[model samples]
Target: MVHGGFRVWSGSEPDFPRQAEQVRSLLGAPDNPALLPPQFVAAALTGIGGMLITRSRADALVDAAFALPTRDPSVILAVRHAANRPGATRLTLVARDRPGAPDGTLVDLPTDWKAQESVFATDSIAIGEPGSEHAKQARQLQGQIWQSPPDNLYPTWLYAPVCPASMSLVALHGDRVVGFLLGFQSQPDRDGTTVLESQVMGVDPDYRNRGIAVHLKHQQAIMAGMLGIDAIRWTADPLQAGSALLNFGRLGAFSRRFLPDYLPFRNELNRLPASRLRIEWTVAGEDPRTELSQHRLHLRESVVPGTTCPIANDGPMDLQITPGNPLIAIEIPSDWTALQQSDLATARAWRTNLDDLLLRCLGEGPDQYLITNAVIHRGRVFLLAEQATNNLLRLYS
Candidate 1:
């Protein structure tokens, strides 16, 4: 009756059997239908019903045959209803397995599950301000000045700007000063916008967890926003996981560049492994500020390739720069192995150079001449200093 397909008025009609046979033949079925697992049978019937109903078949026979009186007959009923009504589609069954089978089963997902956003907001905490109990505590717990010379004394402020008001501090409670953030404001980026640069962060041994660092970082971001600053930038120690994650993962900072063994005072500080990672948080571009915040400097590979400068065709040159001088550039073997790999003589020669350079820089003043950059190409070491006038190499001995 519809679309030239078979039509039926009721289940008991004589034409129903003929139409059912026709539907079964269209589906490539045998004269005697095989008994299938309930789920398989239900799924097959549903598919057939959909196709038959879409053709505008007027026969109610297809519906009646599909709707068998049995337990869990919803599938058949659903398919039958869909076939009889115009534009009616039955709900799909996404079962993982067929009936009477035990391998895979259907699963229902929780309705209340939700994901957290990448950026988050929180309250601000004042840092480095006068009368801040945390700052005072940090000052009190400051480590002793190791190997201090006649002029320098204990508790000497290693790095400066020495202002109690401008500097910010993250208060950490633990064995020693386990975690602390120290930062100061710096000149604005291109747009005449002010920014805060976190100088250093120290985490004590015992209190690594408790999310104290996260709390401190959140507060810092909030303060940066409130201070009308357009961005926040900082250098991180790449080896530290907590520090790295806080800046890169949580804060959404990206790494821009790497500086290898960028600090000369490392030896004087008992050879503490230190690398510089530049990270920035921009405020204007997107909500909650988005910017590359983590840069890790791979020291050995970056500074001294193959572990040492190669022996040049012209041989090594005697390089000399006076005390208080900014930098002393030297030409050494480019293909030479690393200091550890080099012969004792070669290693001692470079160590001597470093010793002389450091002593000269130390003579200038305390906390001077930090090795800010290093580059290794074809086995040559290029070291750059933070100060051109007051050398840092002289501060040690």
Candidate 2:
């Protein structure tokens, strides 16, 4: 079991090896030595054998990092970052972990800075492929964007553009990149009907509430139209009232397909049974924007909401879901984000219940019911999707 100066871990070894073993088990791979870098393993051993750090302290440190609600393997990145830094223990230890990343400009850009088309431009932020001068700044921004408000952990999946076809647009404020559209053009269908999947799009918290998200989305649509993509599909937590308003009310996207626990609940901001509603931005369909506008007006005018599911501060539960009603309305939390922060247990309960109800409302495919609009009335939010024909695809046609 001995390897020159150090022997491999045995169950007999005290604190470090045992604690390391604990971390390994928590990681769901007790026998996998590949889980950690050699330095981390050595650090644990040195601390254990030397009796420099207590098991309690070691346990606390390990738990906090493993507790990141992520299986991103960047937990090791967090560890490596911590180990490399000689000083600034508090800063390093408290730092958000990342996967193995490189410094300097990325070498794998799909399109050159000059050749990439400029999608959108406002007085403040412009969306395009930024030049090399902004790489390090962009890197720093990526790390900071998650720790901010609105949506945190979702941005972790979007660490610089992962998709193809130049859907990777960066929002630049002067020389610094403030927002990023980590999107990509998905594969074409049989008729070559293109689809653009918006993986993750976010503006810096400091730069939010300024219509930056709107600008990015609009620019993406323009780009999609130019490329002749039929629709843009994206997923979002149905609890986000603001996002619901923007996507359904403003951007003309609808949730006809409800995916139960589709997103992994690994992020701190996320709740259990991570259900998401797939938003379809039908760019070329029967004018969703115009229909949405009319739907909004109708919601305000005279159309009575047939069914209502009462949702409380604790979350939606013990509910009544009326499927056959022409216009069914399900009440949602006014501020689900705040609700999750205050009491997550209630949030989890709400998520689990909402999953089945939403799915029942919006069936599987073109053969099922389709959602038309989302309306907010009298401090209550209602999903406005009439039970369409059995062949729902006809509505799109």
TM-scores of all candidate predictions against the true structure: 0.35, 0.61
Local lDDT at 392 for model 1: 22
Worst 10 residues of 2 by lDDT: 86-95
Give the Cα lDDT of each candidate: 0.37, 0.51
Report the C-alpha lDDT of model 2 over 110-165, residue by residue, as the tens digit: 22233244567787777775443443344456446434322222222223242222
Q: Which portions of model 1 miss their true places by more than 4 Å? A: 1-133, 140-165, 172-178, 267-273, 283-397
- lDDT score for residue 259 of model 1: 43
Question: Residue-wise lDDT of candidate 1 within 1-397, one digit each (tens)?
Answer: 2322423222344554355445444433432222111212322222222122212335333332222211122221212222333122222221211221112222221222222221322232222322233443444433322232221111112112233113444443322333455554453445665666655554443555556566666666776677676676666543333455466445545443444444433322223433344565654323333121111132223334323332111222234433343332233333332332445466445444444444344222443444333444564444433343322222210
Can you tell me which runs of candidate 2 are displaced by over 4 Å?
A: 1-119, 132-166, 285-315, 364-368, 390-393
Q: For each candidate in turn, give its C-alpha RMSD to the true structure in angstroms.
A: 30.4, 12.5
Q: How does candidate 2 fare on TM-score?
A: 0.61
Question: How many steric clashes between backbone atoms does each model show?
Answer: 33, 1
